[model samples]
Structures are given as C-alpha cells and as structure tokens.
Target: MELPGGLGGNDAPDGESLPELLRSWRNRAYPREVSETAAPRRRRSGLTQRELARLAGVSERWYGNLERGEPAEYSEGFLDRLSSALGLGEAERSALYLRAIGRPPTSAVAPGSAAAAGMDLTLQQFLDNQAPNPAFVTDLAWNVIGWNDPLREWFPWAAQQGNQMLWALLAPQARKQLVDWEGSWARPYLGQIRYARAQHPDDEALASLEREILARSAEARKMWNLREVHEHADGDLRRLRLPCHRGREVSVRIVALRLMRSDRLRVNVLMESGRAVGA
Candidate 1:
C-alpha cells in the first residue's frame, strides 16, 4: 500500500509537518550543550542528512526524501534504524512510526504515556496451570517469553534460547533432541514465521529473524526459498528425544492456542504419552 507522502504542504497532512518533526528530532539527537546563563543562546548542533542516512543504514537520497516529507516507501526496517540513529526513546519511536507509517510499530507499543510491559501477567498463570504437560508462551515474534517447569525439564534449551524458531533451526541441541529434525521441527517452525510474515509484512522483528535464519543455515534457506507457506506446528505429531529416557524418542503432539487477549501471543503445549515411540 502506497502511503500519501506529499511533503505536507498541500492539505491532508500539512506539508511541513513531518519535515519539521524529523528536523526537530535530528537537532535534538546532536544538541549543542550550553551553561545555565548560556542556555538562553542554546542552539542545535549540525547533523547533516548524509550523516543521518549513514547512521540509519539508508541512502542519503532516501533519507533526504523522508526529511523533506516527500513520497517514498518507508519500511519498518528503515523506520527502526532511523529511530535508533536519532536515539529516540519508546515514546519518541512510537510517535515517529505514527508519523511515518500512519501507525505505531508493533514492537514499540506505548499506550497513553508509558511503554508497554513485554508480557501479560495472565500468560504466566496459563502456563503454570498446564502442569505435567510441557507448555510455553511466545510473543508474535516467536520469542520465548514464558514456559512452565515441565517444559524446562523436557526441553532444557528453553531455559537458554530466547527465541523458539532460532533454537529449532540453529541450535545444535535441537538436532540431538528432535528426531527427523528437518521434516518435523525446522519446516513447521519456519512455516509459522512464513505465515506471520504474510499476515504482517511490516513486522520488523519477524523480518530480522527470517534474515538471520537465512544467513546462518543453508537448509533453512533452501526450504524458505521454496516459498512453501502453509506449515504450522499445531496438531502436528513430532518425535522428541527425551534425555531422561536414555535418548529414547517419544511421540509428542503440538497443541497451539492463541491467547484470548492477544492473537500475537500463543500458548504451545507439547502433549506426550508415557510410552516411547520406535526408532
């Protein structure tokens, strides 16, 4: 979707509005210090467009267009980098996104005045309540936010790996623990990310995760480049090699549920029978 980027003067967005806002933030990023008495004469230090573009990992021409409030595709990546370059806080980053993309970033959600707390308290309760079975919760980006003790006991890597997909695809422990690692774990987890990217094309964290996966694993890159989009772990049976059982494999079925409050947050339970499966 092409956003209206008419440099603010004509009427809809008030031409100079975005330009002035970006310029103000740029000045603040590199402000000239002044004494109490000298504060009266305090002024902005020079922060050229070229310098900002270099810092933001964008071309000078692209950033110049943004500074002038002209029409251009301002991606979430670009906006994130720009926010970082200008040293914007949560609130500032939210405001920048609102101005740039007509909506605040999915990651930088600030309700009213303060930044959002990463996870909901209720999610922990949900995880703990699901005892015996291995259960965990992940945010939209598939970052492992919360997990139950049973999960930590079964999938020990859950304690160290911050991201679920990253561990499934990149961690050496994953190959040792999951039988048929490629067909069972990697493909399904990547499928979830592929589906998410299709749904929210502007999610910066998701995009970054996909980029990292492609860069690190050739197998992942091949499957990803195949462009298959319908893989998901919910209801799929997977063979899990349990450490306590002398590396015996067990058939575990994945049950995924979206948290009632947020579709982005999911509760994943790995249900397994007491018996082990064949090799």
Candidate 2:
C-alpha cells in the first residue's frame, strides 16, 4: 500500500491525521469526481473521511478509529460496504479486508478481472504456434479468450460464444463430440459451475448461467443437484468422438496452466493419450 508522492504510511508529521488506509481512501475517486480535475490531481485527492463515512452509512469517528488502525471488531459485510462506498478496485478491497479482518474476503471474485475479455498476443501466438496439439486460454469463468486452429478442430465452437463451460454443458456439438456427455462433460462442468456459484454467491452472472443450464439441460440439472464441486480439471482424462478422426474415439489428458501475471488466466493444452485412425 504505497502512498502518493513517495510518502510512507507513518510519515505523518505532528497533528494532521494521514492514516494508512485513510490516505488510500482519500485517493479513491467517485461521487464527486469533477471532469476538470487532472488524473494525477484526482489520484492525489478524493472523498474526505467524513464524507466517505457518511456515504458508507457510518459515523466519522468510527471510520477514523478504523482508519487509525485502532483494534475493533470488523465484519466482512461492513468492510464490503466500506469498499463499495469508497469505490475501491478488487485488489484494493481485498487488501483492505485482509488488513482489517486478518483474512481475505470469501466473495467469489473473477480471477483475472484486471484483464476481462482481454486477449494477450504472446499467449495467443503461443496457442497458435502449438500446431497439431490442441491448446486454448480461458478466463476464470471458463471464457475462452484464445485458442489454436488445432483446438478449433476439436472444439469448433470455442470462438463462437467463447464460454467453455456453456459449450461443454449445453452445446449440441458437445453432445455429439464429447464421449459420454453426461458423465464426462456436462456433470463435471456443472460441478465446476456449482462450485463457482457457491464461492461467488453474489455474482449475478453465475446465477443466471446456472439458471440457463438448469432450464436447458436435464442432465445438468441432475448433476448440479448432487452437490459435487471441484476447483478445476487440471489433469483429468477425457475421451472425444473426433471429426478429424472420422468419429473415432480419442483420449486426451487435460493440462491446465495459470499465467504468472494473472492466475485467473488458464492455458489449457490437451495431451493426446490415445489416437484412432480416420475411418
């Protein structure tokens, strides 16, 4: 939590109060961010502690005490409200929760929110260069943001809606191509969605996706009810009925990679376990 102008957190002289979190909060712009203000100036200025407290529905004294790092019981909900009031970014809010509560918030946050719908050229080129091998990149919510042509031979719809979970669970192509669509694809993906929904209960998109899945697919509804959950299919084996192999059964191992810059960006490369001759 570095302060502006290279000032340390405890660099406050004599009487003027410039607490650590207070300084951070004072830099958050919202509600009264007039257009004429320069970006640097805006970054250096924001809501007053009293104004912020009012917006957060708390008294100035309470906000001051908390900002001053006075030991007080802080609830996640309260911190969440404060975060909303301050218009904090996801990382900033998470840091605040950790600082105040000694733990990160339990809310399900999209891992690569900083790069939402972003396609990195290095990653895309890497995927494109992985010829013959099936490779692709997906965001935290399984949104396919990048892929190779080889992957398209496996999943032609990857570039369509760009959501792997939806494609695996509800797409007609998945039913035709994925071996044992219920056991192999739908159920597993539904479990993943279920886990995501549980972790991010406040996410309306996940909720809406869950509803659409339940409404469109009977198998998904059943699997979702089983209460199964897993983080991801990092090293799972899956069989596919390949069009490239003239509908022959092929087995592949799933290899999952998280980017160093953003853990939420998943790079999945399929390693073939078994091959079938084209009929």
Most accurate candidate by TM-score? 1
How far residue 151's Cα lies from its native spot in candidate 2, in Å, is: 0.8
Best by lDDT: 1
Output the worst ten-in-a-row residue range by lDDT, candidate 1: 31-40
Model 1 per-residue lDDT tens digits across residues 42-143 = 445745676576555445787999888786557665576566557677666766776776776776442211123246556677677777778887767665
How well does candidate 1 score on lDDT at residue 151?
85
Task: State each candidate's clash count.
Answer: 3, 0
Candidate 2 regions exceeding 4 Å error are 1-115, 274-279
Task: State how far residue 225 of model 1 sits from its true place (Å).
Answer: 1.7
> lDDT of model 2 at residue 196?
78
RMSD of each: 12.8, 14.8
lDDT of 2 by residue, 1-279 (tens): 333333323422323333665576666655442111125343335777765654443457878888887767665434654665566667666667656665666764433232454667788788876666788887656656678888876765553324677657765566887888888877778887878777778764466567656765787777788988877788899988866778688888887887888655778888787532110
- Candidate 2 has which clashing residue pairs, if any? none
